[model samples]
Target: MSDTQAGQIGEDDHGHPAASKARLRLWLKLLKATKHVEAELRENLRTAFDTTLPRFDVMAALYRAESGLKMSELSSVLRVSNGNVTGIVDRLVDDGVLVRVPVDHDRRATTVRLTNAGREQFAAMAARHEAWIDEMLGGIDTSEIRAMTDQLERIASTNAKREG
Candidate 1:
């Protein structure tokens, strides 16, 4: 049985344990909030930068890696298929935002890294992204945000323990 189902021996029409129902409601709320934020960001990215979120995500991953990453490594880190990574990498390369270099020892392998221009471009976008996020979440009280973060961290830790 799944971790959630383990507590379902006496579930009702509404899925009792009250805690379970509460968690389900919380999950839905989280999903809705995430979608709302993402939709805004998606529209803003297109309007402001003419870039897709996937491209931004790929660039963000590359920015995090100082030495760049292999195509396969990028795929793994981004939780995407190699073909998906290839397309983004191709476009970025064409835009002079990134370069693919052959590995010295591995003739068949190549690594993708951001160029200086890419770094500058992404840095600008990242700052704007941060402001967007702040604006999106500006309505929430700071204390409530802190409390929610702490609760989410506890849930994350619990899930990590279970998965580990």
Candidate 2:
């Protein structure tokens, strides 16, 4: 069974407790690893710019989309709801980090792009973000990082397809 299916009683070669316990352990291990990475990133973001990870994520997504992206696109990319995107966008817009422009094709549908100030801020923070990611994973060897990244990407893709 996969790690997530670790609910059934498991057995070892000696017939000791096996089934679900092993899966549970795997899940717990994954969770702990994820939590450690997240905490490190959270602290890095906090110290570097006094911003939360979610806000950074939203901004980074906008910055990456050269021509900007619609709220729907942002929502899908960020795996957040429209209301959540709206609030984040509103906050950023208030701070002049992003602008909402009416769509030429659909007036009601607005596209969000980083403003000059937003671009500048993102650029500054981006360098720091890259540094932090590198530092946090510095102990990981290059091959390991690549392998883990590929595995995680595959898992994420499967999950997205499953959940979406």
Candidate 3:
């Protein structure tokens, strides 16, 4: 079959168009699965913890950085714009869950970190978040999960290489 015909039906034996079609399908399935899990997590976070996914994400980043990260650094780590991080950090600061510390050398720059309370709160939320993921993926076998994780990691590495 010609490439266009092979692509249309995913029937090529030699593999360019067929592989492309298969990759497209895989991408769609991955996106759908991700969105499904994300939506569930978002709702769970909202109902159980009275928090939004973005807030949880910000906390998660800060939780990993013990010493704290500057506002710009946090924005970069989260792959979000500074303005977007600003509002969430502001709210978190107001709630006493995070604190802003002035940078010694840069008067205008400040680093943000989780407070003790924030750490405790995130530890609990993280435990539950893990459980939620486990429950959702309960049907998948451990070996299959590992294989898929490896494949995804490869894809990420390849994409990063391409970008760099």
Candidate 4:
């Protein structure tokens, strides 16, 4: 291997480069791309709706569940702590965007669903979000999209296998 390749891999046992170096580089590139897109999304959400990304994510999960979801379910679906969700839910409730209903036959349990106004507001945001994503990824062709999607799916499967 060349000096640069050796530097990248940090020198192998026999003084050659390691095989895992390419995978490490790929992981960093993927992380960078994800952060770039996420930063743009955060800025757009802030400027267009005067809202944060976490608020948008919570609404999105509630939007998908027409019948609403329990507090635990919301936490699990959003992959966030209950405290994080509770703060956002409280703000949204104060804004008249979500309504908390006592679960049937269970006074101790509460479920959250979007109000009519919330539905309408989310629809508007969702439309703009879709457009923003399309604009950002507009340069990538359909074939490349399909190829990348397939590769990512394979990677996910490999990761799942390890966990399982």
Best by TM-score: 3
lDDT of each: 0.92, 0.87, 0.95, 0.92
State TM-scores per candidate.
0.86, 0.80, 0.90, 0.88
**Which sections of candidate 3 miss by over 4 Å?**
1-16
Query: Residues 41-160, candidate 3, lDDT per residue (tens digit)?
Result: 999999999999999999999999999999999999999999999999999999999999999989999999999999999999999999999999999999999999999999999999
> After TM-score superposition, what is the CA distance of residue 159 in candidate 2 from its true location, in Å?
4.4
User: Where does candidate 1 stray beyond 4 Å?
Assistant: 1-15
List candidate 2 stretches off by more than 4 Å. Answer: 1-10, 13-20, 157-164
Off by over 4 Å in 4: 1-18
Candidate 4 local lDDT, residue 45: 96
Instruction: Find the 10 residues in a row with the least total lDDT in model 4.
Output: 3-12
Local accuracy of candidate 4 as per-residue lDDT tens digits, 1-164: 88666655465677655656667788999999999999999999999999999999999999999889999999999988888899999999999999999999999889999999999999999999999999999999999999999999999999999999
RMSD of each: 5.1, 4.8, 4.3, 4.0
Q: How many Å off is the CA of 95 in candidate 2?
A: 0.8
Q: Rank candidates by TM-score, best first.
A: 3, 4, 1, 2
Please give the distance, in angstroms, between residue 143's alpha carbon in candidate 4 and its true position after superposition: 0.9
TM-score, cand. 2 vs. native = 0.80
